[model samples]
Structures are given as C-alpha cells and as structure tokens.
Target chain A: MKLKRTIRQVFAIAKTDFLGIVRNKTAIFFTLLFPLFFLIIIGFTFGTQGTGETSRIQVGTVNLDGNMIDVNGTVSQNSTIGDVFVQVLKDANFTVYEYDVYGDKDTNGTAAYDISRGEIKIAVVLPANFTETLSYQYTDSLGIPIPTRAHLDLYTDPSDPTGSIIGQQSLLGFISGFIKYYQEIAINQLPENLQDYAEVLADPITVSTSEADVSGRQLRWIDYMVPGTLGLVLLWSGLNHASVAIATERTKGTFQRMVIAPVSSITVLAGKFISSLAIVYISAVIMLASGLLLFQVNLYWNVPAIILAIFLGALSAIGIGLIISSIAKNEEAANSIAVLISVPLQFFIGAFFPLDIMPEPAQIFGEALPFTKLVYAMQDIMTKNLPFEAVMPEIIYLTISGLILFVVGIIAYRLSLKRL
Target chain B: MNLNDIEIDAVTKRFEDTVAVDNVSMKVAKGELFGLLGPNGAGKSTLTKMLCGMVNPTSGTIKVGGYNIRDNAMKVKELLGVVPQDIVLYDYMNARENLAFFGKLYGLSGGKLRDRIEELLKFTQLDEKAVKRHISTYSGGMKRRVNIAAALLHEPQVMLLDEPNAGLDPGNRLALWEIIQTLHKEGKTIVLTTHMMDEAEELSDQVAIMDKGKIIALGSPRQLIKKVKMENTITVVPNKITPKLMEAVKKISGVKRSYRAYDEEEKIETIKIITERAEDILPEVVSGISSVGSKILSVQLSRGTLEDVFILLTGRSLREEEQL
Candidate 1:
C-alpha cells in the first residue's frame, strides 16, 4: 500500500511538473529551439570537406618504348609524308594521348596546348618515319649523344586562378625529378622534357580516404546533427531545469511549506531528481522520434542497450542539474551559475569539434568530461553499431560521477536547510 | 505546566552571535485561543517555529500534545498545522492540488487525500475557484486562504499562525478571525502571534504580551484589565491643571495613576485620572481646579480597555511598544 501510494504521488508530482514546463512556452523554446540553432551552426561549421569546387589537379603519365637517334643525331620518328595532322583530346592518366604526325605543313596553325584544366594538359605527336628511326639504337654514335624522344604538347584551361599557379610551379618539381634519370642526355637543369611535362601536369595531386568505422554509406548532415542535438538535450537539462524548479518554488513560498511537511529533505530531493529524469528522458524520446520521422536517422527498436545508455545519460545530466540547484539559493543565481559553468565545459568536451581535430592534450581533457564520453558512446551506438559493452568505460565513469555529485548535493541540501 | 497543553520551555535561539529568542517559556491549554502579542523582533515567530519543531531550540525543549519536539519532531509536525505569515504554498499548483500534496505528505493518500482536499477547499471558501485557476492567479487574500488550507490538510490538533492577518484588508481580516474562532470551537488549540493589540483583545481567550525576548504579562483580557485598579471605572481628562491642582487630584485616594495626555495637534495638555470610584473623586478634582484652561473636557469614563491596562502596567500605550 505504501509503495503504491508513493508511486501515485511521484507521478502526481511529475504530471504537474511536466504540465508546468510544457505550459511555459519560453522554457520549451529555450530548451528545444536553442539546441537546434546550435546543431545547425556547429554542424555546418565542421561538416564541409571536399564540398566546394576542386582547385588543384591530380596528373599521371606513362612512357612506352623509346627509340634511339640515327647517326646524324637527326634520326627520330620524323614527320610522315602526305598524311593528315588531326589533333584530338583524350583521357590522360599514365598513358599519354598520341597525335600521329603527317608531314608538318603549317602545323603551327593549330592551337598551342592549354596547361590549366585537362587531366594531362598535353599530348604526344608521333612521327610517321618512326619505322627507320629505331635502327640507330644498334650503335653508339661517337661522342654526339644518342637521343630517345617523344614530342608532346600540353593543353590547359589558362582561366582558373588556382590551376595557373600550380601550372607554373610544377615546372620546378619536374625539372628536379627528371634530372635524376634524364641527365644522361641533357647536362643542364632546364631540360625540354621537364618543361613539357610541367605544362601538361596541371592537376597537382590527391590522396582520398574512407573511414574504417562507418560502413555502407556516408552520414548526411542531419545524421551528424542528430547525435549533437541529443547531447544538447542532456547538456541543457543538466544546466537549467533543477534551478528553475527549485528556485520558482522558493519564490512562491512552496519550499518552506514543503520543508514544514512530514517529508524528509531526501524525499523532496528524490522527487525533484526523479522528476527531472523523467522530463529529460521524455525530451530525449521526443527528439529521437522526430529524428526517425523527420530526419530519418537510424533507429533500432530492438536495441534495448541503446535505450538504456540514453536513459543513464539523461539521468546523469539531471543529477548534475540537481547539484547545481542545491547550491543556488534563487532562480537568478541558479541560472547565472549554470550558464557560467556549462558553456565552457561543453566546448572543452568537443561537443563543437571532433576529437580527431584536437591536439593530444586537448583530446585527453575532452575524454575526462562526461559529455565527451556520452557523445562517444552515443556515436558508437548510432554510427559504429557497437553494443553496450563497448561504451562501458564511459558509462561506468559517468555513473560514478553522477553518484558522487548526487550524494554531495543531498548532503549540501541538508546543510543548507539546517542553516535556514 | 499542563501536559495536555502546548509548552515551549527555556527556548533560546542564537543566530551566529545574535540571540533572537532567549529562554522564552509559554504554555496554553487545549482549545485555547492564545495570542502571542509582541513587537516585530520579540522572537514570537521563532518561538512558534520551535513549537512546531521546525527549528531546534538551542538549550530548551518544546512539547506538543505531550510529545517532546526533540525526540518527536515528526510527531509534532503531524499534530501542528502551521499557517506561516509569508503565505507559503505551491503557486504552480492549483488550490486543490496544493492541498492534496500537503495532505499526502502526512500519509493521507488515495480517496482520503482527494476528499480532504475537497473538504479543505470548502472550509477555506476556495472551492468555487479550486479548478478555475492556479494559485499564482489568486489575490493575496485568496493565496493566504490556500496557505491555510494547505496547513489544515492533515487536520492537525494545533493551528500555529505567525501573523496570519498582517497584510489582509478589513473584510479578509474579519473572515480570517471567523475561521480562527470556528477552529478554536472545534477543540483545536489556536496560537497566533500578532502586533495588532485589538485583535488580541477581541479573539484571544488569553494574551501573552511579549517584549524584548520575554513575556511581560499573560492573562485573559478581562483578568489583565482587572490587574490594574480600573476594574469598573472611568477616566477624567481636564485641560490645563496647575501643579498644586495636580497634587490635589492625586490626593483624592480613589483616582489612580495621574498623567498628562499631551495633544500635539491642539498644543494643549490634559490630566487623565483612572479610578473605580471616579464619581466620588470627581467633586474633589473639580473644586481643586480654578483656571479657565483647567475646565473638565470630559468626565464620564465607563469601562477600561486593553490599551488602558497596557498603559497602566508598561507606562506606555500598546502603540508605543510597537515602535520597539
């Protein structure tokens, strides 16, 4: 009978409390709306990567068999007789595009290569007399160096500002690189092959990546925002609710009436703590429901473990709020103290930035704050598909922190009431 | 001391270095409407709090219905219904819910809690507005009523009030007095502290006049008046009596306690005389005064009031004690 009555009274208080908060439209908006505003702000600030226009280039080339120069050093794949000299564009990745050379009659009438936008920015034009040019490789022609050659022309955009800068800088890189191998023929640093290669290599470089943790598909903006938004509920719940409940009661003379009752200080505190827990959990469920309905974030109804973690996280938050409320004598002081402490803690915990981007010391500090661990635990459940045991480290520590704080708050409340 | 009565014994409360209540002792019978009359800092509220076991006495004991407050604080709270002066109540809750919550705190639950709340609402005359609005929307008088209702939820035997009528309008004050009278007749001991002397005069069966952390006088209003010489008498006020005439008036034997009633507005002084044998002393006082300004302004005094009794004992009016 006593248990039944206690439950009934608890819910009775809970219902009135819930109604009070819901009826306060300003309170509702500050808790729910301000978090959404932060979610959007922080989400967009860090979410943009490889989203804007591509500036530099990624260029590759392959060299096929080379032919030696004939005895007069003028032997090569010389221009063929009476053949068309048509130029065409082709994909460049390690194999250069070839433009077969007919006898060079006014070949300069065609365009000079553009070295800004295309994959290779240039192509090689093959001489048709190349059948006889290979016969010179059998002999080393005196002291006059034997030449192996492929004449290439670079085509580029010339308009993109970023492309223009790299289009010029690569000339220096190619000269340094080519000097290691092509120096047998040309002793000077500015080799013709290096200059031509620089003009064609417009796309600079790239090394793309994929996360080993997130599988199947990349998370959308809303997916990332969901975890952060949920964390914010805990954060705000911890920072605001208890102070409002207790302080308003004090102002209305309700606390004095309550203190005069047959109820112990512990019972009053438990009532408030449980009420806060219920409210924060309801808010979490609402946010999750909205996520599944409006944002289509991942939801696994069978995952009791995830639900349990969420409940614990919210309870820890409420415990923190109760500690704050216990110290605050009035609504204004409670609000001032809560805001003063929570904002900086949230930032230090990396609710605004990923831990990967922080330095090692900062990462260590972030791990110490409860929200960072909570956020990690949530990310694991939602994104990593990890089980509850995977987040036990965080769960155990946060629960301990919450317990210590709760006990301390109760003791402090008793002391404060004693002084009163 | 009556074990059946409420008693606060040797109760001294020290706040840091300042002693607010010092070795105060009081006792009243069951069903008594007792007035704890004091100035603002006479420690009356603290004494009441001790009776309800809200605060622990530094070096004393309090007993409610024979239960010591130290050993049985909860039992004391269970028996005492405190209507605090500040009108403390859950404003977020409606009148009915506030009553229900307080009722449940003492183990009244389920249908009983609801029924008690309903009955209290009717008793406090708040039933009509019970469901219509929250307590915050109520007027000051209505809030005070709800506060009283919350206190009466558990049906305590003693109703302790700390100036329940301090800030009410005359109509509300009258209505509140009627409620206190009804409670007292129902065999509940009602102890209230107030600075309003006339309230103590009208409603109190016994008045405890406290000043400077002690009760200077305690008795029924009539008994206290009879303690002075004006049990069935009148006072004489004659303007402009000479020194020799004042000596002659004091020597009339039946006349008691001659003093000047200085009128600041008229800038004139009057000699007042209180006597049970005012008719016998009137002719003697009349023949002794011979100046034009010494004419008797009013000579017919019938009954003595609490104010006259307080003046006779404390050498000042009740209003004068208030300035302390």
Candidate 2:
C-alpha cells in the first residue's frame, strides 16, 4: 500500500511540474530554445568540412618579380613565373588579390594591411629575382649545368587561427609542387645517364597520405559537436532547471504545503527528478533533430544507448543542482549560482572543445566531470559507431557517479527540509 | 482518557538564539472551533506549524487524534488539513487541475478524486468558467477559497487555517466565516490563527490570546472578558479633549479608569471612561468633561469586547501590538 501510494504521489507531482514548465514561457525558452540556438550557430559555423563544400580562403599576394626568362630562356611580355605561382594559388582554392610592388616600395606592408583589415587570411611576397634565379644556370668545373634557388615569403594573420593554418599549408604544398614541376623539366633536358641521377636527387623520399576509416564515413566538425551540444542541453535542462525548482516552491509557499501533506520528502524529490528527466530527454531530442535536419550530421542513432546515457547524465546534473538548491537561500540566488557553475562547466567538460588538446591537469579534470563522460560516451556511440560494449566503462562510471551524487543530493534535500 | 482532539504539552520551538514558541501547553476539545488570537509574530503560526508537523518543537509533545507528532508525524499529518498564509497553489494551473493534483497526493484517486474535486469546486462556489481559469487570473478572494479547498480534499478531521481571512475585504471575510461555520457545524475541529480580534470573537468557541510566545489568556470570548473583570468603556468625543477634562472625568463617581486615546484611522482624539455600568456613568462623565470647559461633540456607551479583554489583560491594545 505504501509503495503504491508513493508511486501515485510521485506521478502526480511530476505531472503538475511538467505542466507548469510547459506553460511557463521562460522555462520553455531555456529548456528548448537556448540549446537549439547554440546547436544552429555552431553547426553552420563549422559544418562544411565533410559535406564536400569548401569555402575559399582569401590571400593577398605581392609580386615584385619582373618579367624574366623561364627555364628555356624565353621571356613573356605580360606575365612572369610569379604570375604563374599566383595562378597556382587560385587553382588550389584561394581567392588571390594581387598587390602591385612599385620600384623600392614596401609591397609586403600593403598585403599585411589587407590581412589586418580581415580582407585576407595570408600574404605572399615573391622576390624580384624569383623567375631570374629559377632560370639562371652556370657550368661548373666539370661543365655540368647548376640551377639557382628561388625564395618566397608568407605572412599569416594570427586572428583567424584555423584559416591561417590552412592558408600556410596550401601555399607551402603549391610551392613544393611548382618546384617539382620545374625540376622534372630540368631533368628531362639532361643526358639520359645523368637524368636518372637528377630525378632521384630532386625528389628523394616521396610521402603518400590517406584518411583512416573510423566509422565507415567521413565525420565533420558538426558530427563531433552534436553530442557535446546534447551534453550542454542536459546541463541546462537538468542542472539549471532543477536548481531553481525547490527554491521557487519555497518562495511560492508550496514547499510548506507539500511538507504538511502526508508524504515523505524523498518521495517529493523523486517526483521532481522524474519531471526533470523528462525535460532532459525532450531537450536532447530537440538537439538531435536539429543536428540531423539542419546540419545533416552523420551519426549513429543508437536509440537505446543514447537514452541510457541521457538518463544517467541527467542524474548527475540534477544531483548537482539539488546541492545548489539546498545551499541557496532563495530562487534568484539559486539561479545565479547555477549559471555561475554551469557556464564554466561547459568548457571544462569539453562541451564546446576537445579535452585532449588541453593540458594534462585539465584533461584529468575534464575526465573526472560526469558530463565529460557523457560527451565521450555519446561521441563513441554516435561518431565512432561503436557498440554498447565499447562504451561500457563510461556507462559504469556514469552509473556509479550518478548514484553517489544522487544519494548526496537526497541528504542535502533532507537537510533543507529541516531548515524549511 | 484523552477527551481533546489536539493536545500540546510544554511545546517550545527555538531557532538559534530566539525562541519562537516558548514552553506552552493547551488542549482543544473535539469539534471545538478554537482561535489563536495574537498580533503578527506572536508565535501563533509557529505553534500551528508545530501541530501540523511542518515544524518540530524543540521540546515536549504534540498529539493529534491520539498520535504523537514526534513518532507518528505522518499519522498526525493525515488527520490535519493545512491552509497556509500564502497562496500555495500553482498559479499556472486551473482550479480543477490544482485540486486533482493535491487530491492524488492525499491518496485519493479515480472516481473518488474526481468526485472530491467536483465537490470542492462546488463547495467553494467556483463556477465552471472560474474553475477553468488559471489561479493567477483569479481574484484574491477566489484564490483564497481555492487555497482552502485544496486542503479539504482529504477530509481531514482537524483543519488548521493560518490567517485565512487576512487581506480580505469585509464581504470576503464574511463569506469565509460562513465556510468555517459550516465546517464546524459538520463537527470538524478547527484551529484558526489571526491577529484580528473581531474574527476571533465572532468565530471561536474558545480563544487563546498569545503574546511573546506564551498564551496570556485562553477561554471563550465572554468567559475571558468576564474572567478579566473588564470595565465597560464610555467614549466621549468632545470639541477638544484636554488633560484637565480627562482628570475631571476620572474623578466622576463609578469611573474606574479614564484616559485620552487617539484613533489612528479617524485622526481624532477621544476620552474613554471605564466604569462598571457605562450607561450610569455616561451622563456624569459628559457633564464632568463639559464642566471643565470642553464642549461635547458625541457620547457613546459600549460593552467591553475581545479587544478590551486583550487590553485589560496585557495593558496593550491589539492594534498597538500590530503596529509593533
């Protein structure tokens, strides 16, 4: 009879609380819209990689080189080898803007100014002797022709970190290819016996690259971020919402009414947990749906595993919220403290960035956070397409930690009941 | 045999350094409409909460329906219906929804819960349209009625109403008084706490006047007035009340006490002459004041009431205590 009554009371409380949240505009905004806002913003910002869509990087080029002879000693009327190199950059997915270099003026400075103004991500300067040196040849004592080396300078914008790295890499790769093309032409002009030695000397140690098969499909930045975004949604729905629940009730005088009822405090808390768990799942669904529909994120659905992970993650998040609610004197204080804890917690738990790139101590701290484990478990199941067994350790950690924190939360709630 | 429905023995509640409910003992008989009368913060609400098992007494025992609150708190709670001072219902939910939610918490369900909710909605005189509207949109009186209705879903034997008529206009207070009287007529024991002296005198079968965490006087309103031997008051509002006029009134035969009292609400001063029979002393008092060169504007004779009883017992007006 007691167990039946407890179940009935819990459901009653959950039903009322859920209805209250549905009707409350502020609650609806935080639970559904806030996290969706983050997902959409982050998704559009970094979701172009695996979708076969590429945005061109803008680069400023300063060509001081005069029209000089090519390797065949023929001069072009309108363009030099520096123009050919600029054409190579355009072909390699760069929007190149050419900066004119007058007699001894600083043309590199002009390129740098465009970079600072956000018009370009990188600046490239070609020396006046660029084509002359590449075409210059001399006979050694043994009467063998030797080529002179050419130099190029690149200045990258520090503000756009990712763009700077991509610009630098692409420019370097193009220059290497250009040098190899000229080397092949030079080698072909040599005698047959010496040509093989020249070919070997010019390109000694060729390197080839291929992407590793992680999940049978290429993963984009959106795919990696979807799970982290889900964790963030849970943090707000479970932690922030739960933190203010009891304080709001106290302020509204409902807490005293509940206490006066012939119901245990733990039973009331269980009802609150059930309502918050429902909210967590609703928020998670909205996040996943937005990711799949808006960004076309390629992730394994893994419904049962995802449900289990969210349930456990909500336990930890709500548990921490209960602790905060117990400590705060009122609803406003509870809300302020929850935001103070949750904002920094998102970064620390790798909800927005990868923890592996952080320092050792920070990585350890992230590893210890329950939300981080949820993010990792989600990444494994969604990105890696791993089975349940692959994430069993994370599941076990979440379950144990969630249970421990929930127990502590119950104790704190009971203490708060006494104060009330 | 315990004849009382509620018994509080040497109950005290302290918070840190302050004592909210000092060591006190009282018994409320079965089916009695008991009033806890005091100004704000006189520990009436604290004592009511202790009886409801919402607050634990620092010492002693409270028994409701023969169940000790310390050992059988749930049993005590099961027998009591609590209507808190603040409006405790979810403002976003309609009246029926709020009632149904609380009904389920009391272990009522299915047809029984539905029937109880319907009965309460009808009993509170909330129409279908009113029942469908959210509590936040309801008037203060309507919300107070629903607040009381939520506590009645379980049909508890004892009802605790902490200032149920507080902040209500005279019409609403009369309506609530009718509800309380109806409940009392059904033989349900009730403990009502309020700072309003007239509410206590009008509704209580017995009244306990508490002050500084202690019960200063306890009995029926008439019994208390008689026990205190309070004198009838003859109020004379003259064109002007002077110290010499008040002294002359005090020297009149049959006059026991005379003092000039200011009416805060009326913004006027009057001289009150306390005597055994106000009718016999009224003419003499009026003449005494007029002989002292004071022109009589009005003269009235009235019997001592609960406020007079409170003033006689504590030498402080109930209204004065409210200001403090």
Candidate 2 structure quality by residue, lDDT tens digits, B46-116: 89989998889999899999899999999988999999888899999999999998888889989999999
Residue-level lDDT for A96 in candidate 1: 30
Q: Report the lDDT tens digits of candidate 2 across residue range A1-420.
A: 889989999999888878878999998987667888877886787666554332466777888776443443445333467788878777766688888642122334477667776678878888766766666543356655565677888888789887798778777777788888888877888899999898888878888877778899888889989988878977889998889888888878888898899999988998899998999999999899888899888899899999999899888999998998888999899999998988888887776678977899999988999899999999999999999999999999999999998888888988998887
Which regions of candidate 2 are displaced past 4 Å? A50-56, A66-78, A101-110, A137-147, A173-186, A359-361, B236-277, B280-297
| Shift in Å, residue A140, candidate 2 | 11
RMSD of each: 12.4, 3.6
Q: In model 1, what lDDT does residue A322 have?
A: 64
Worst 10 residues of 2 chain B by lDDT: B256-265
DockQ of each: 0.29, 0.77
RMSD of 2: 3.6
DockQ winner: 2
Candidate 1 structure lDDT: 0.65
